[model samples]
Target: MRVISLQPSGDLTLSTDAVKPSPRPNHILVRVRAFAVNRQDLKIGPSVKDAGVECVGSVEDAGGVKGLRVGATVAVLSFGEGGLWKDYCLVPAKCVIPLQVSPATPGSPLDPATWAKLAAIPLTFLTAFGILDNLDLRKHDRLLIRGGTSSIGLTIASVAKALGAVVATTTRDPTKAPNLSENGADFVILEREGGIKDDVRMMFASKETFTSTDELSTPALSTTRINDSAGADKCVDLLGVNTVQDSLLALKGPGGICCLAGSLGGSGSTSFNPIKDIPSGVYLTTFAVDRVDMGKVPLQEIVDRVLERGEYRLNLDRIFGLEDLDKVKDYVEGNKARGKVVVVLPNEL
Candidate 1:
């Protein structure tokens, strides 16, 4: 079996002589068909054996798990564990999500195009769903997604739109505006170095008029003064701590929720003071995949929405074979991908 080996010097190499893994009790051995190359893979330490985290594969051995049979199509998630960058992956049954067998390709793996699209779903879509659930998003709400070009960001935009929210997204490059719009972003804002709060305010202007208070005359103007100009009803900040404060300031009013979902802008600490930085009546929260409950995530429904019903678009940017691992890193880390980048294993493997 061949697998991506991580060297101590923080480099990766394809090792062809590796032995395939066997499933333990309550575990299933999966034959990986395709895997998504994620930005989080870059941060993985060398101590981890493999170099990928999410994959779409077939069950080789179901380990007697209820309702799981051999050759069932499934999505495997290996977050905070051994990765799935090889011919076979050994994961606990709980980590395996059984997908609906494709009617066109029943009892067999999906076509290359379909497998690649399915590979893009597990991690990004699940994380996006968790973030939106935490924010308590409602239909017709004005939702803003900072760093919208990311895979998870794009997924959020599509899913939110399906749920009837008016989605607004931010991108650093103006050329990517069309891509965002095609994936269900009703409005796209160009993100500047500081933030997009001003841009979001302009797009989602408050209907109610308020008199601007004189700074010196008020002696102690409440943070509500900022809310007077706030616009977005909710925000999912994928840019991390650096832009979360800015996203918070763009809320339409008090009680607006802002969820910090990604660290695409770098996870460095920010000088955030709750009383001084967080707007009055605005709530700031964080969504960590490992900490969130996955039971609430409608995995089958999400798959149906993207693949079956066409309610959502899986923004699959590019597909690479196993041999093009180097190019995969370059495409994702260089921020060249506007959405998911997938790596498909050859049938011979």
Candidate 2:
């Protein structure tokens, strides 16, 4: 078997003489077809060598699992210590979500492009879905997504819109507002030089239906109050300390919940004065994709929704091969990719 490992010099190198990995009693072996690169991959330190979180592939051996069989097309969510950027990898049967690509589907004969797109969804979509699900978002709820241009951010916005929520999102880049609105955001608040809190507050104050620069529009803000307060029903904060305080203020007083999912700003120390920062009776929580219970996540329903809408597609910035592991890592680390970067493996291994 072949594997991609981080060398002592902090570069990803390929080794063709690596030994094959066997599946545990509760796991299944997958022949890697394609995998996606995420921001977490960049944070992998030198102490831990191999690094990959998710992939799309076929089951080679099911380890006697009843539902999973050999040669089943599946998406493997590798949340454990093991990496997915290899010729073959072992994944728990519970983490394998079979994609819908039967004869009746539109993309019956799944092409490489479609397979690549499906490969991009698991990690980002699952993370976003878990946070939103925890927040208990209801239809027509005024949902605010901080860091809306990020992969997980975009996924949450699109999925929330599909579920009938009027979504508002923030982005540092004003130009991306149109793109975000077109995808699902009803209102795109530009993160100005000073801060975005005032802009967000003003948007809620007007309670008027307005069109964005991109010409995307939504219904006027409903007069109904969230717990008798004047802000959003819930907020999914992906910017961590950089935006958490403002996010708290942007939510409804007592009943609002803020799910901290990402630290795109900085994961280091942050200052928060509980009395002034956190709203009265507002709940604050954090979410980790790796910590999510696979059995409880609605993976099947999420995939079904994407298949049904066909509008919210994962953007693919670039693709690479297993041997080009160094280039792939460099590309992702550059922080220039607008969407998911994928690595496709050879079929024969």
Candidate 3:
């Protein structure tokens, strides 16, 4: 088994060995197939004190556990320093999902890569669902998908579009328009162009049946010149940089809800006076699946939605092997990946 560990200096030390990980009575054993190198993985940037959590890995070998079997394919979510790059990984029985899926590409059996992609789908999809479904998203609801091209953005856009809500996803570059539009995004804007708030108003206006303002059942649009600026009822901020503050400025007053699934932007430290842009009646929250699934219902409803309608196509931006693990920290932190950057285990798929 092999795993990549990071040092404070930003160098990667790839260590290998066959060590058996202990699974609780409620645990499942998974064989590593394919894993992802996510933006969250770079937080520990070879220079940070203790890079909080590292996001990576997917499918696994089923070690004869209660619900998981030796040949059963499964995907595992690593929120913190989860070790899955090695040949085998262990997940709490509850955290493990029983995904009955065929290979994404026909006639192909579920390998680590396939399983890894499947596994990668859960966490992001879950985060998006919480924002849209759990929060009661509406078709007419406007949305701001910040960090538009991130692995996080891809999943959020797919689900939001399915719900019939017009989506305005923000990307760092304009080159992503064709790809983002194909994924169901109605409009794509660069993060700084007053993205969601500005573009959304124009799009809604263009689709308007009549030019008269009296015809709109909705309130006046709220914006710079519009007096009542139009804003997202729901905003998904994957970049955590000054999140609370930035999102507060983007959210519609009185009813908007902001869900912070990742702190990629930086922490919501309220760098400045929080009251300035903070609107009344807007609810701000940060949550994890463990907390959401507290007990009433198993995640069967959400998981089923993904299995039946889930599309796992990522723009395979780049592929790296064991020897290339060292370059990942630099590549990811530099924000160079065009889409989902994945690393395949050196062994055959």
Compared with the true structure, all predictions reach lDDT values of 0.84, 0.77, 0.61
lDDT of 2 by residue, 1-349 (tens): 8877765566777788988887778788988888888877656465747767788887888888888888788888877675887888887787787765543456554556666777777888888878888899899888889888887888888888878998999888877778787777899887666566666666665333333332343345323333435678789988887778888888766677888888887777768876778878888888888888777777666666666556456656787777677788777776566667888777666
**Residue pairs whose backbone atoms clash in candidate 2:** none
Residue 39 lDDT (model 2): 73
For model 2 the local lDDT of residue 240 reads 84
Model 3 quality (TM-score): 0.74
Off by over 4 Å in 2: 8-10, 22-24, 103-110, 206-228, 308-312, 323-327
The model with the greatest lDDT is 1
Query: On residues 1-349, what C-alpha lDDT tens digit does candidate 3 reach at each position?
Result: 5666666766666767656676545566665666677655554553433221222333344444556565665555545445555656666654555556666677776555554445455556666666566557788678777777876787778777777787888777788778788878887877663334555444434221223334554456422232333566777777764545566557665577877766666664555454555677776666565464523433445545655555434445676776787677678777777666666675532
lDDT (C-alpha) at residue 251 in model 2: 78
**Is candidate 1 or 3 superior in TM-score?**
1
What are the runs in model 3 whose C-alpha is more than 4 Å off?
22-25, 45-65, 104-108, 111-113, 193-229, 241-243, 272-276, 289-316
What would the TM-scores of all predictions be? 0.90, 0.85, 0.74
Backbone clash count for every predicted candidate, in the order shown? 1, 0, 18
Every model's Cα RMSD, please? 5.0, 8.2, 6.6
